[model samples]
Target: MEVVIGLLAVLVLFFAAGYFIRKNIYREVDRLEARKIEIMNRSLADEMARVKELKMTGQAEELFEKWRQEWDEIITSQLPEVEELLFDAEDHADKYRFKKSKEVLKHIERMLDAAEQNIEQIIEEIYELVTSEERNSSEIEEVREKFKKAKKTLLAHSHTFGNAHAKLETALYEVYEALKLFESETESGNYLAAREILTKQTAVLEQLCAQIEVIPALLSDCQTVIPNQLSEIKDGYEEMASQGYFLGHIQIQSETERISGSLSLFQEKISLLETEGIHESLQEIHESIETMYDLLEKEVHAHHYVLAETLKTESALQELHAEKLISKEETDAVKLSYHLSEEETSRLRHIDKQISSLQKRYTHIQDKMANEKIAYSLLKDELIELEKQMSDVKAEHAEYREMLHALRKEELTAREQLSEARTLLSEAARLVSKSNIPGLPAVYTELLSDAKRSVSQVSEKLNELPLDMVAVNVLLEDAVSASAKVREQTEDMIEQVYYVEKIIQYGNRFRSRDENLSRELSEAEKLFRHYEYESSLKKAATAIETVEPGSFEKIGSLVEEDLEELKNK
Candidate 1:
């Protein structure tokens, strides 16, 4: 009984699956039918009616027929084929051949797609034709209005257009011819051809209008503006030439003539309506004219500069010459007393030669100015160079003059230093002699003699002819150092002698009681007599400090005070 129930259940499931498969297949069939109906109901007829409004000849008529034939084929043949496929698909599903039903359904879908594509292509072709016709109609009217306006402008101001007038009129006629061609094509029911013709004519009209617009300005510049500028340049050139300006190198006349010839050729080009690069040519010509003007103006400015600077440069040159003469005089006078180096004398002569050459060049420049041969610009450059040279010469002269002046000042300074050194030496000798310290040691005597000899050498250098101050200063420096040393040693020796005597006298009391102290004082007295005051003082101070430490410090300060007093005396 359980096995019977399971078998019954299996039958139920099979029936149910078959029922679902049939339902799905029928649904697909219904969808295919709907798609077929959609293809049939397409407004291909309505879209074709739009094309009827256009001229139905040439490509338009042929394409319309083609679209109609294609739509008819889809409706009659392709859609029926899809319907048959859909019926086959339903029959396969009923027989429980689902795989076959699916295959038939796929075939039906492919046919519907092909029919739909054909319908879309036909509608698109019709739309393109209709849109082209409409656009061609509206564009032709706009271009025609613009063409007439351009013609009117060309006619009214034909003179301003100069040579471009006849050429522009011919171009307008060509645009009109194209318009006629468009009309001819339109009348023959070649709407697309007419559209192409109208499009080309519209472009031609636009270019013609642009040419007409810019031609007048280009002509004005070529004919009037640049020519006037060239005339001004010519007039200025002639005026400057008459006024004795050296303007031959500028070649203003030749350049202006060349530009004029170019302008004539460009005017011819404008007449032929070949104005592509003529505007740029005119602009270049204008710039060339301006450059010529600048050249002429430069010459005038240079002439003024030469005239004004001639006087100033002459004055400056004269002043420089006078300074050179003064330098020569001062150099001569100073060299008589103080020796000047050969390099110094040679530099002075060189400066004189430079000034003389400058004078000669200035004379030549003046002659050129009088003859009016060289350009003033060249003369101005020469003058600027001359002024620079003059400034250099002045600086050289001033430096040499200062050198000459320094010679006398240096002589006086050397003499003053010599006098100070002599006084210091005399004072040192006087101090030593008045000290009454038996006598100086051999080294002190030798240094004092050396100091005197140095002073004598400095004086001898000052007395020589063409006095070499360099040697004199060297001798003077030696004298100053030697004299200062003698003075310092003299003061120190005298103070030590006085302090040694005082310390010995102060130690006499201890000497009678201490045999060692008495014996050391005796040695110090013998050293003092031998003029060995430094050693004598050391021996006495050491003996005294053994009995009394730090006793010499107070004695040293007292010795300093006594030395200052002796020097003041």
Candidate 2:
């Protein structure tokens, strides 16, 4: 049995190894095959044939053919080796020889890598050879013609071209230098190196030409357009400053000097047309002028903003000052009514002093701004601070007013509740006087006294000057609460008396019918007469239930019937 199990285990491992190889190895082989297919589809042969038609130097074409042959040789020899190895790997996997199969797959992978590298290298060589200067000198000439066209366009607007002349002339010379280098290098059989130079020079010349072509418009914007805008910016700034707008002490002299210098410097650059990097200089100057224009616009906008806001802030401050608030009498009244703390008093004084300080500062700022002693920017923060402080003072005053209003409303409401409580207390006293029942709970009498005392306290508070309203409000609540308790107790006592009378009469119905009932009914009558209604009801009702289970319910029906008959009468 042990041997059988061991053999079965070995068989399982063998199949497992076969499964591992089949799954892993076949997938790897498929990937390698896909890579091979990609290489074949690269069309290296077709590309070589395409390059053959291009008019390249004989030596360059020979070099391309050499690499192409090398690429073909690697594919022709190594590809078959990789395919054979793949076949071997598949066979090894089929036979459950995973280790051998992995080795075969590794070999195929290496050969395929080499084959791919060879094709890529040949493709690079073919591209480089075709793009060689000897083969594409016409492209450089096309760039030269483009530069000349750009130059002619600029010269047509000669007045505007002054700023960009140096750049355009330098670029044309660079084109000449590149052409000479290309011809010299091509004659000396250095086509690739010459072509590289041509490509660089061609790109530079084209970029410079593009820069030169737009000089007419840029020159107009910089020379005519921006200077005019600068004047407007200067005028706008002065206009706002004249209108009492605080403008920060911004120096325009340096900026105006800089603009003049830049325009003059660029004009010199355009005169030195033979100078190198003139294209760069023109672009720099154009950008600088454009920057100056943008800055001028920002300054103009900033000045106007400050002007408008300063005027509004002045109006708001004047209005706030004129508004009736923050009076000593009003603040004193709040302090007296609420009995505010010492800290609150000190804070209020500090706020008043702060407002006074702010007023002085505000006047100083306005005077200085009018006299050109400060810029608009200098007073902006001060204005905001003054506005905020005034607003805070107003908020404090408003809050106090609201509190006073609410307290007054509370006083009225509390007085109304006190009146209602007095009425309830009177009604309870009258009911108790009329009922005249004995043996009541002393707690009810105490509550009645409490209600009367609470009313007295409330009335005293009301009678006082200024009313100590908070205390009065609390006393009124106490009075109302005590009155409600006394009323409930009084009403309950009266109802109990009425119930005791009803239940005693109900027990008499069985007085003659049962001797035991007679004795219990008599005992219950004594308890009822003592004002022990709850106890009396329990006693009489228990004895009565021995005769009739729902006798107490019947008694309730009789009391309701008696009350209804009395009402009808």
Candidate 3:
């Protein structure tokens, strides 16, 4: 019984599996049928109707027939094959042949794809033909209008185009012929051919319009403007030549002839409509003419400059000559009193030589100007250089004059300083004599003697023939320093002596009470008698300060007051 039940369950499962397999195969068959119907429904017919609306002959008619035939083949042969495959797939699924049904469905899907591609290709070809026809019809009208306008402009401005008018007319004729060909091809239904012709003619018309626009100005420059300028330049050249203005470097005649030849050649090229390099050639000719004009104008300007600057330069030369003479006289006068260095004398001689050389240059320029053959531009440059040299010479002359003045000032300063030093030494001597400090130390005496000698040396130097002020100033500085030292030392020594005396006398009061004070005061007296006042003052002040606490400072103040009073007296 268990075996039968297992066999029954097994049969149930086999039927259930077959049912599911059949259902899936039916689903696939339905999907492929739907794809085939969609492929059949593409709008290729409407696009074909568009193609038929155009002029259908020649290439257009032939393309239209080919596309229509391809569409017919897809609808009749390809789609029916897909429908047959769909039916076969449905039959296989109904009989429980799932594998065979899948194979048939796959075949139907492939057929549908091929038919869809064929329909798309036919529709695309028809659309392309229709669009080309429409574009050719519209664009040809525009191209014709452009050609008409361009030809009209060329006719209106034939004079402005100069000799290029004939060649330009020929180019317009070619464009007109191309327009005719486009119309002929369009009428014959070869729109693609018409489009090619229209494209080429449109470019030609645009180029011709541009050429017409600029040719007038360029021709006017070449024919009238440049020739008039050349004529004016030649006339100016003749006028200036007669007026004694040297204008030979310009080569005006040959250059004008060459430019005339170029203008003629340019006219020929323009007649043939070969305007590629003519614009640049005309520009070069204009620049050449401008350069000639500039050269002539420079001569005119330079002639006026030469006339005015020549007189100014001559006056400056005369002034410089007078200054040089004055410098020589002053140098001679100073030579008798002050010794001048060799470099100083040589500098004056160098100035003289420079002035002499400049004078020669001035003469040469005058001679050149008198001949009226040399270009004034060259003369102007020479005169400018001469004026600059004169300016430099004037600067040197001013500097040398200041140097001579400084020499005299320095000599006078040295003498004044010497006199002041002598007076300072005398004051120092008078201070020593009045101080009554028993005698000065040996070093102080030697310094005083040296101060006197320094003063004497400065005076002797000042008195020497061709007085070397350099040496005199040096001696004067030494005398000033020596005299100041003597005066400072004399005052310091005299104050020290007074301080020592006052301190010793003031310490005597403490001597009776402090034996050490008495002994130190005796030693201080000995130092004072020996002119060792500074040492004596320190010894005495130390003893008194030890006994009286602040006696040294009190005595120093009193001594300072007494010395101030004496100096005033």
Global lDDT of each candidate: 0.86, 0.69, 0.86
TM-score, per-candidate, Cα-based: 0.72, 0.64, 0.80
Ranking by lDDT: 3, 1, 2
RMSD of each: 7.8, 11.3, 6.4
Per-residue lDDT of 156-253 in model 1, one digit per residue for the tens?
A: 89889876787888889988888898888888877778878887888878778888888889878877888888888888888888888898889987
Q: Identify the runs in model 2 with alpha carbons over 4 angstroms from their true place.
A: 1-148, 163-167, 170-201, 217-222, 234-248, 259-362, 365-371, 433-439, 513-515, 560-569
Tens digit per residue, CA lDDT, model 2, 459-536: 888777544666786788788888898888887777666666776677677788899989988888888776677778
lDDT of 3 by residue, 1-569 (tens): 99999999999998899889888887887888787777777767677778788888987898888887787787888888777788888788788888898888777777777777777777776776677778877787777787788788877776788768888888989888888888888889887788778777778787788788878877787789999999999999999999998888889999999999998887777777667778888889989999999999998888899999999999999999999999999999999988999988888999999999999999999999899879999999999999999999999989998999999899888878888888888888888888888988988989999999999998888888797987887888889999999989989999989988898888888788889999999999999999998889889888888888887778878998989987986
Query: What's the lDDT for candidate 2?
Result: 0.69
